[model samples]
Target: MRRSPDLHLPQATRASAGNLPAFLAACAVAVPVLLAVSAGNIADPIVRYDDYPALLAQPEGFWQKTLTEGRWLNYLWHLRGVVTPAWLNFVLFQILWGVTAAAIAAAAIPPGNRKWFAAVLALTLLPAPPVFLMAPWSSTLIPGFAVLALFAGLALVLSQRALRLLLPVFTLLAFTAYTTFPLILLAVCLISTRQRSLPDLAGLLVLFGASFAGAVLAVYALNWQVHGVFGIPLDPARSPDPAQDLAELWSHLPLLQETLSVLLGKLSFQSTPVLLFHLGLLIAATAVLLRRQPLEALYLWTALWAGMALMTLQVLKLGVTIPVRAFHFTWILYAVLIVRAAQELSRSPGLPGRLARNAVLLVALSYLVQTAVQFTRFRDWQHETRAMAAAISAQPGPVYATGSILDHPAARKAGLHRASSLELLTGLQLSQCGAVPEACAHLPPRLSSPAPEPQPQARLERFEGANVLVFPPRQ
Candidate 1:
């Protein structure tokens, strides 16, 4: 590969030697905010198509599904649920991901300010614009697996050949779960790394390219093991047919501005244009300031542009709008900007310094407000789901949805983006069948018909885009 003269890399520094302590402290600082971010899920409601507690509870379910599509990491992620409550399991993983993100950021930044950088990064993740924290279930939590994989890649950069050999194993376990952010975050780390042990800008590109190729191969292999097929689904959670999802992305390629808006957190329930703007401005400023260090600024610019291109595809079932959890790159980008701004401000004293500081503060404050609103929506969603469940359970033999939509503002906001079924809220053991086929629309006489057979408890209902909250999840 040709090394571009324009690519200037950061000089090597030794301040990051205390990464172990910084990593621990960053986790401590991030936990409380993470808890607050998803507090509503602690009490009630599962969002979207989350499998979590229900599917995980089964003996041969999420907890024991090792080597599954090479996504065994996600199942391992939830093993805590076996001992802790569902809410705690959900919150813990969110915190873990935040901490992992922070550690990666801290390591990639200047040594002197790494701790503060990590802490700020941690604070930004949950309360950030793309408030994926408000969601519950296995699908949202899968992002953590990607973060872990990114962290592993960073470790590989420093590890000797022996440990670097384990990179493939780590990729096999993590890449099958999520891919949108791993490539982006790895690039960020490589650019930000002080020369200490890292190579030049071209080496950074080589590193990311190698990491990506390894992850893809791992997923390619794992898909065969778990899905009993030979295919590469960049993210298996989207759909069994990832090719269709890719088609959705290709179709939306022309709507660049519109698609970018969605990627930056402009969903029905979470509208955060301002937070994203501040993040952009702050990072852009940081990049300009680092132009002297050729590589960092270029990667900053590259990360933003690359992010716009590598969009998270909204599976065919959900249309073309990607889910908020898929915005992991955005979360990392904001965190990196905050830290980079702080590092620059400390070195200078002027109006630009104040502006950078204010930009970061505004970004944080904006995210805080968005996070609160998201949680309030979550609380309202749970309350309405419970009330509706009660109303449905009190009915006669079988309750057909009067209308497919739930009658609540929060639920309408949720509409087709949330959980498999509100039946979990009903808390009744009554036999429930999903989407009664046209042929089975009318049932036999209750007196002559045998007792309603108990249905499988798993959330395996096919999603036909009609009221996602009421329907059982896809198998």
Candidate 2:
């Protein structure tokens, strides 16, 4: 394949004001602070449906689960939840976010082209994802490996020789946690596409594959010794018919389109103007970048296709519902592509450049406020849920739990749902009275007639529009 014309990527576009410190510091500080505000609820959420037997599981039982579950590094972070309060263990995630942001800043800002705007541009619109911060479910919080891969990949591009040797070791650490499938692939695709030469891209791809395989083998060996399992659990058990999910691409094209549309529509962070602004920025960036620099725009297009291919493969392999987390990195990648566009436009030699630069900065600051206002609704859900849980725990026997806290109008307005009795009352020492079939039956008195018995143990309370049966606390 012939090479496209040179890109004004960081290596090519860095101008010498020698102003690295300011941009680096801004990203390092800004991303984390924004993250803290958007997701800084340090309260213990009721354990999720899938996450049950986690907080309730004693410290001793968790390690066994970690082995089969895969994602050891992730589980190691989870180790805190079982040992102490899940809330406290969650603070460790904040530290992880900090380290991730700082590390990415180090990788993206340096020797950056386009004056020092790369730092600011790296986080152009939405910075940290709110889901990772809410920490409601660890399943969706795989940002750790993704970010680490990004840093490692970018560092390799910086010619960090040590990483070439260390990438797999680190990839092992990440892979052992989340099945290095996406992270390794992302890193390789990211670095390789940034390359100016085909040979370099091929070499990097080989290195990524080899390092990742080494990590996978190492994990399999460890599991073999510990659990007598000979196989690595890399997502869905690979089937004989790789195309089983689709069976035939032509027939399933409609399904794929519908799936994509739903994913875009269900982005929790989208609230009116927020969605509009996101789309506007993307369209504007793609148009500007494609016109101004088609070859570089090809890089974004290639990366996007690679991301979608991974997501499609995952959905096909899993043979089930669409995982929202599949969209997580792709969403971030969209922001990144737009950020790169804004940065490139900022280097133009005319009034249009000035407008592009200023407009992008305004977009950045605008989203900063939007993030705090929009995504911060998570805290409200937690607060309301806590009050309801406290009410339920205070009641006596056979309190009918409709799982109503989340069903209330206030919750739906906030883009929150799914407050399972099993999940919401676990740490509260309360039982669902059979309202939730799977809810703990420690207090097993089913409401005979959808009404709590009139006694000191029962107090009927109301939340939003839902009737909440409160039981007096167990003595």
lDDT of 1: 0.51
lDDT per prediction? Answer: 0.51, 0.50
Compare the candidates by TM-score and give the number of the best one: 1
Candidate 1 local lDDT, 1-475, one digit each (tens): 9985535632221232355566666767766766775666665545453464433444245532334334545655555454445565566556666666556555655565667666765565546545454355534354454557355335524533323344445444445445454554544454445542325545555655576677766655665676665544333443333344556645554444455655544532344665456557765666655754555655655665555545533343233445565566666665665557566665667887677666666666566666666666566566666766655545534433312233324555554353235554555433322343342244333211223223211111112322112322222
lDDT by residue for model 2 (315-398), tens:
455433454544555555565556666666656578766766676677666656655565455555556556666665565443
Task: Report how far residue 437 has shifted in candidate 2, in Å.
Answer: 7.7
| Per-model RMSD to reference | 9.6, 8.1
Q: Model 2 Cα displacement at 408 (Å)?
A: 4.2
Worst-scoring 10-residue span by lDDT in model 2: 447-456
Q: Which sections of candidate 2 miss by over 4 Å? A: 1-23, 39-69, 78-92, 109-116, 125-134, 138-158, 180-195, 212-255, 266-300, 379-381, 388-428, 435-475
